[model samples]
Target chain A: AQTVTQSQPEMSVQEAETVTLSCTYDTSESNYYLFWYKQPPSRQMILVIRQEAYKQQNATENRFSVNFQKAAKSFSLKISDSQLGDTAMYFCAFMTHVGGSARQLTFGSGTQLTVLP
Target chain B: GAGVSQSPSNKVTEKGKDVELRCDPISGHTALYWYRQRLGQGLEFLIYFQGNSAPDKSGLPSDRFSAERTGESVSTLTIQRTQQEDSAVYLCASSLNRGSLNTGELFFGEGSRLTVL
Candidate 1:
């Protein structure tokens, strides 16, 4: 099986600043996927970004970017120019194909980020 | 709605009782997943459904938890003899395809909060 770990249980960042949340995982599979999800107070889980194992380049989406160190098995999320809307519970997830088109995700404990004003 | 839909945004049930949570995936989505989020914890994969293949039940914590998806649309997660440990938010997600495929993006619902007391 696979396991994802988020050492930070909580984090706070001032608005317009930058913040990085740490994540690590244990997996033996060579090909897989990584994802970051955000759950706001409304309880909706939203996909923030994704990274593919085969790619050496980290994934980025606007202010959301990832520093993926394959050798260290580390995938951290960097949020730049943070906004109050970024305050949420962030999760790091791992996935690998199970069958033809089936896959399962293993997720970390999560980091509650509060973007302070 | 254009997004995945989950019912009973909030459900409070007594211990040992049975509770069912519903999810309606976005139209045309071929894959669906269920995850559990306990208080102050990361998401735990419960089950996954893709196309007409057998659903993956490996992630289920126990036999007390079972889920069924009708075709490619609606899914229901049933917890029998619920325990206090079952008190958590149940999240549902749907994807165009599994990870490593098309988008590999899972669109999530707001989630159903279950409180077993």
Candidate 2:
């Protein structure tokens, strides 16, 4: 069994500023994956970034990056140069790599992020 | 569509009524997933289908919730005698056959929002 937790319920960042959303997960499996997804008001879930347990290097995509601490079971998402479009509900998810493929994702409670001008 | 598709973007039904939500996964995708998100909450995984394997229903909250996928394409999640607690967004996602190969990218649909009054 796996569980993800996001302590912050809401966060705000000024346009062109930076913000970091925190996440923590509990898992017994040694091999797994982590992901961050953004859901805007449009109701679409978009992939933000991903991290692999086997890789020590955090994953980054464009202005979105992650700080993955495997020992602490923490994975946080950092948004640099935030824009209005960055406002959304951010979700942290975990997936165990069982027998080579992906399994169901365990998601956190979510953090609502608002980017203001 | 180039991405996953879900139908009945918004469904409002009275408590005790039955509701069905549909999902169309990306073509050629071998994996499909169903998840639930309550208001101000993160995703709650419901079920998963991979290739021709037996679907995993471990995450379903109760017997009132059931889902089916036909030949790795369309999936339908049905709630029998829904309760007020069933009000939430139902999300669907699909991933390439690479799921077993460790590529965990899940293309998601816009989701079907259900309101039980």
What is candidate 2's lDDT per residue for A6-117, written digit by digit as tens?
A: 9999999999999999999998999988999889998888988888899999898999999999999999999999999999999999988877778888888999999998
Clashing residue pairs in candidate 1 (N, C-alpha, C atoms within 3 angstroms): none
Of the candidates shown, which would achieve the greatest TM-score relative to the real structure?
2
Model 1 C-alpha lDDT per residue in residues A1-117, reported as the tens digit of each score: 899999999999999999999999999988788999998889898999999888999999999999999999999999999999999999999888544353778889999999999
Q: Kindly give the stretch of ten consecutive residues in candidate 1 chain A with the minimal lDDT sum.
A: A96-105
lDDT of 1 by residue, B68-96 (tens): 88877899999999999899999999888
Candidate 2: regions farther than 4 A off: B52-54, B99-101
Candidate 2 chain B superposition, TM-score:
0.93
Q: What value does DockQ give for candidate 1?
A: 0.64
Q: Write down the lDDT of every candidate, Cα atoms only.
A: 0.89, 0.90
